[model samples]
Target chain A: MQDDAKLIEFIKTDLARGKVTGKLGANDDLIETEILDSLGIMKLILFLENNYAVKISDEDLTLENFTSIMSINSLIQRKRAAQGA
Target chain B: MDFSFTDTQVLQRESIVEFARRELNDKVRENDQAGGFPLENWRKCADMGLLSLLTPEIYGGLGEDLVTTANSLEALSYGCEDSGLVHAIVTQLCCIVLINLYGSPAQKERYLPELSSGGMIAAQSITEPDAGSDVLSMRTRIEGDGAGWLLSGGKVFISNGPLADIIIVFARCGAGKSAFGEISCFLVEKTAAGYSMGKPLQKMGLRTLQNCEMFFDSVGVGEEMLLGKNGHGMFIFNEGIEWERALMTAAHLGTLERVLGKSISYVKTRKQFGKEIGKNQSLSNKIGTMKLNLELGKLILYKMAWLKDQGKRATLEASLGKLFVSESLKSACLDAIQIHGGYGYMQECDLERDLRDSVAATIYSGTSEMQRNIIARMLGI
Candidate 1:
């Protein structure tokens, strides 16, 4: 599995109970697919912050930044670059 | 555990108490009877900087932490006889705080300064007719437009609805999203073409605060109006509820003190059977219980507020605090009325209105039953 897949798996396992309910695709929108309800999204945000050591600021909380696993991974990469990680 | 307030907090509390006592209590009985919200008092509170306690200083706010906000609200409630007006203030302030936390920079630029300065009133639109406690079951929908969204639905029991300039409306979206998944929060201005408000709904208590039903019939909102990202309504709404439950009832803490003081004074002075009512054990025991509830409720509320200030999620603590303080306020009001005997029931004593207002504490920001459900879930029950 790819590194991005690992994060997707984490979200899937915690929020969707490891079930691929057609909403866990790599490019599927977590908010749009209903896989991550509001509370689930919050939990996922915390999960990414804690596991990856990246801060998700309010400006980064938009749909363009968090729509899918790909977007989330890209955001993390950008944040890491910004921090010179 | 240290429960001491900082000197700054103490001074803030004192000034708020003084202001409320001097400016807010006038003609309260007449206003309550007329169901009139005194706009002057609302602006007075704004001028005192009470309107902007939680927003950042750059946005024209006092930017106080949660504990200080709670302390100031408690002092205001203690001094102010107008609980309805305070209720309106909390509703508007809660909306402002949520917007500050979630609004885009542009959205903030448009609304925050006016909201913080009390030049504009804010209200949150939730609690539909079929979806009060079952918030996820709301039927309001937001369909994607070319560069915006079209909202169509109705919201009931909207606090400050009639007077609000901007309303944070929650609506459904997404094709196959779960009930919770499809919801999104939108910023709907009252001037929107299809947006309209019903007349204020008269109530038994908090009469001076205006509440109404709102309708959005294909109201168009640009991308700038979304408070947070789409499908994140519940999270944003939850944030507000958490703060509201944790701190808004700080006023009730003050109300409890007021009721207790009044009861004590009445018991000490009023003579019955050739002696003061304090000579009676039952009445004195009632007072004792009121005191007990006051102390315990304060500790819970203070802890919850402090946790919020530390930027921690205190869902359990907030629920517990809201549950305790609201119920305690009701009981204290009842005891005060009982202690005052027939006179308490009369509008002249104000205990009747206090009791009426205290009853609503169990209903909004999640009912007592819902709070217990949250607590039980947190306990993994």
Candidate 2:
């Protein structure tokens, strides 16, 4: 969970820098509201895949796992936990 | 605040830069001189994911987002020497993104995988001699046939026309209706009996891109060929135009930055009147303006990307961005050329190429005039 928080911070860091948003005010559905496009989503995927020790196949990047901040946070958490990170 | 790349996006840009510098920088001049497409490097681009960034993964595409694709194109543009190849990639992506977003599943199953992998190149045919900026004014039409529709029309100035594996075409589906409501786009294979491509046409810029005239004489297409709906071609095409016009010139923005960087390096080193040209205010302002355009253009593109991601309509924003960047690039290229002095005018330095290439930014993806028209209408003109 701490790792997930870190990932969220990292993403928020990107958002802040990109001037996308200040802090991702809501925890859920940030992605679906057009806060991030597929490119931003892919960038998030690469970060998670490398840093959080998750294997993000093409299927995992869909709306199901990535539609919201909460879902993305959960996905990061689950993947890290599974990887024993 | 922090509108730049994450570490991965940075690496993506770097990798493409390396590939382009290693493969494209030197060959661009030769290919342009020869008036030939660089077939070898094109496939290399496909292998590297330039072609399939948007097709959904189920169909074997990397299915990258608009942001990733935009960044990648910019990086590639900065490193590579060929604007024509970049334009060709744009044409392919434009057509393919439309198909993936709106084409039927069967269409997806049949085409996306090959397109992503570069086994097929697609062309979009919408412009006509009489219908340049006004897209719906074209006279092409599709009437009902036995099990499919027989399309008959011609599209001119089609990018990637001579080399396309599948051509996405728009034709009128009903008479005496709003052109917007009467036209539909379709997917037709190169091998389709009645679909024929003309010889590649000479272009003032984008010379290596295979822009050509195309003919569709009773080209028969199945019911599955209908993209989106019978009359939704306009909708699907409009959906991506903002990004296409506004942000797709990301590479051009990058080119301005690259040119500015080159000028900075040269001015500091090259002695002019027995002193570095960096000592001049005029030269410094030239680079400053280039830098200004780069940063401003990026912000505009970033806003469009953000807006599109948010499910917001960005037509007005897009037109403004397109208008600003397209005109800025032409001006930047001219300024860059001026800074290079005699060398810039000569073919030896890359500045002349930049100047020639920047000429088309106002023409393609809808002319700058058209963008103004769109913007004016949005402003209630």
Number of the top candidate by lDDT? 1
Candidate 1 ranges with C-alpha deviation above 4 Å: A1-85, B175-181
**Which predicted model would earn the best DockQ?**
1
Runs in model 2 lying further than 4 Å from the true structure:
A1-85, B177-180
- Report the lDDT tens digits of candidate 2 across residue range B294-360: 8898888778766666555577677777778878888988987888899888888878877788888
In Å, candidate 1's interface RMSD is 5.0
Give the range of the ten consecutive residues with the poorest summed lDDT in model 1 chain B: B174-183
Candidate 1 lDDT over B70-96, as tens digits, reads: 888899899998888999999988988
Alpha-carbon shift of residue B64 in model 1 (angstroms): 0.6
Please give the distance, in angstroms, between residue B8's alpha carbon in candidate 1 and its true position after superposition. 1.8
Q: How many clashes would you count in candidate 2?
A: 9
Q: List all candidate RMSDs to the true structure.
A: 4.5, 11.7
Clashing pairs in 1: none
Assign candidate 1 its CAPRI class. Answer: incorrect
